[model samples]
Target chain A: MSSRIDTKTKILDAAEKLFAERGFSETSLRLITSKAEVNLASVNYHFGSKRELIRAVLARYLDLFMPAASNAIAELQQQHPHASLTDIFSALVSPLLTLNSIRAGGTRTFLQLLGRGYIESQGHLRWFITSHYGEHLQSFVTAVQASVPTIPRADIFWRLHFTLGTVVFTMASADALIDIAAADFDEKNNIETVIRKVIPYIASGVAVSA
Target chain B: MSSRIDTKTKILDAAEKLFAERGFSETSLRLITSKAEVNLASVNYHFGSKRELIRAVLARYLDLFMPAASNAIAELQQQHPHASLTDIFSALVSPLLTLNSIRAGGTRTFLQLLGRGYIESQGHLRWFITSHYGEHLQSFVTAVQASVPTIPRADIFWRLHFTLGTVVFTMASADALIDIAAADFDEKNNIETVIRKVIPYIASGVAVSA
Candidate 1:
């Protein structure tokens, strides 16, 4: 990569890590620049403000994540024309589970960041998300509608909203809840276990009638 | 109210509002005191530190919210010796729905704060909540167990955790989603509608088999 691009990538990587670990509000441009080993001028040049920087961070993830999800849906459509609700949900979530496979970034941390974007409307993140990914979200909604033909679109949306809640909340709180489960419930839970557990719960939730 | 008590209430109210709106990390003691019309010394005199102050705010909600939940369970136990899964769910959720009836606080704001408690592990809030509310939580767990006798305790807890994520995530993002639904889907969603929509979804989730 050229120096200019390398500088931008470094800043993005540093921001993503810090935002995930320390949280968006807690992570500062100074911290980000110092970690990235870039100057304030570069940070300003690349992303004008912390708000825009945060949007850029999410946009990076969305760029990677949404394509994988959209492809998953497309593949499901071709392979299983009569896909079940579970299959559609699996397609929606399985790519996220692969975030653990990437070595450079922390999967749970990235998941936490993504979950926070959806759950907490802290900045321009929500608007950035809806406008950018609205069509992709609606496509998933359409996929879900086809799977559960009888369910009302409103019911599907409401349940899907509930499903998003479960995903975001569970992913965001994964590490803490893992420890708490061990300490309080004497049960050990890893990320895979939690996802394995959550999928059916969400599928069942979506399938259940009002 | 006496001056001392008035000062304390003012501090608590301001802290809760700021924390909900700006988040725990983003909201500072200086901002809080200024908003409360109190002084720095008074914040120190009242809550000791921001961590403790956050815990105290949550404890306030638990004081009001838990008893209502516990009482709902008790009433279920008395009223229907054999309450169904939906009944147990209704018992657990109906009290929280009534939190809207009280005018002192915005239900969505309080719910956002509570949801953030579980989603984001800001300071010592997670441990504070688990330790304080563990027994009451276990009681609700047991109530769900009775309703869904076939499900294992571990599965119940995991599902219950998922259920919580759905509740917290949905409630925290209620306002943003309401607008998005209005804008993108041409639908209207409110706090009450969200609650009514959420309960059945949770009940069905908790009852689902692994």
Candidate 2:
């Protein structure tokens, strides 16, 4: 059972990489199996089909990112109890930044898949994200509402949408943007620097006046 | 020559709509030419191949959007002479929001394609954007730097990248995000409302203290 889980994870990791590099349409099951060092039967047994495999790859991200992110935010909510908008926003974003730093490659693939998935709106994957991660987002929205009781509930979601967009886009474009920044401005920018720089912009947006 | 140009625009427009709906890989030349009421020979004559057609579809957008967005920002820069961060940001976003309202379906499809093209980073399309639109973005960066002269140019790029990410993501996820917002918040928010709500958030991010 443990080895099965391990194989599943390895396959997912490989799929994420391929999908990121080649995209959903171009990425083939054989390529994923080859990359993962797993057999086609193993792939079929685990994920059933390419689309399901894509969902599993995406689901793996939520499985890791959502719980960790929500847990951190909940802890922050509990600790401060009267946390400001910045505190709430920080709790939401900092963990992601940390996750990126520690699991850099995985985070990059996840970011790439995220931007692609959302843009592609491939029906099944789209449904998987909304259904699976919807509650996690709602909790953050609730926390945000508590932090800024003045802002309307709808506005909170829109702001969260903006926040996710910023995070996802930055993550997806990380390499290109960093390279351009280095070339144009002669500054050494990395994921950590980007994460740090973006938080304030996002937090300020979350804290914007009605 | 004029009729030829019209036929080309027609094919590009159809390709844009299909690509936005079905994605680049899934969308084929048959689908595009059929939708455009043009023949295969016309498509080949106009753009050489599907990939070139895709490039042409994306190129048409930059041809329109860059000039309009850059001109708006430049005019704002000159008119205000020493505009505030919000003013600079407003000049950048308002034109787009207005364009969204006026064009409605066309803007939405274009936004979808833009997000996809940027994320997919399809080799030719990516090069087209970077080399072609790089100057437009640099001008915006210069205007932003002038507007917020205190902020580091590198930081300005990061912030601007964040802004673009947010805009592109939100635009790409337009229908889905709006649906989620409406379902979660129970308010019937439309594209215009999303645009109006987003500008302030992004503008505040731009206006964020150094």
lDDT (Cα, 0-100) at A58 in candidate 2: 78
- Candidates, DockQ: 0.62, 0.67
What tier of docking accuracy does candidate 1 attain?
Answer: medium
Candidate 1 RMSD to the correct structure: 3.1
Candidate topping DockQ? 2
Note the residue pairs that clash in candidate 1. Answer: none
Q: Candidate 1 has what TM-score?
A: 0.88
Model 1, runs deviating above 4 Å = A1-5, A97-109, A120-123, A182-189, B1-5, B18-31, B97-106, B181-189
Instruction: State TM-scores per candidate.
Output: 0.88, 0.86
lDDT of 1 by residue, A1-210 (tens): 335569888998888888878777678788999888889778889888877787787787677778788889989999999998778877866777666566444456667787866545453665677689988877788888998999987788778888988988788777777887888779877777787788888988898878
Once all C-alphas are superposed, what RMSD does model 2 give against the true structure? 3.6
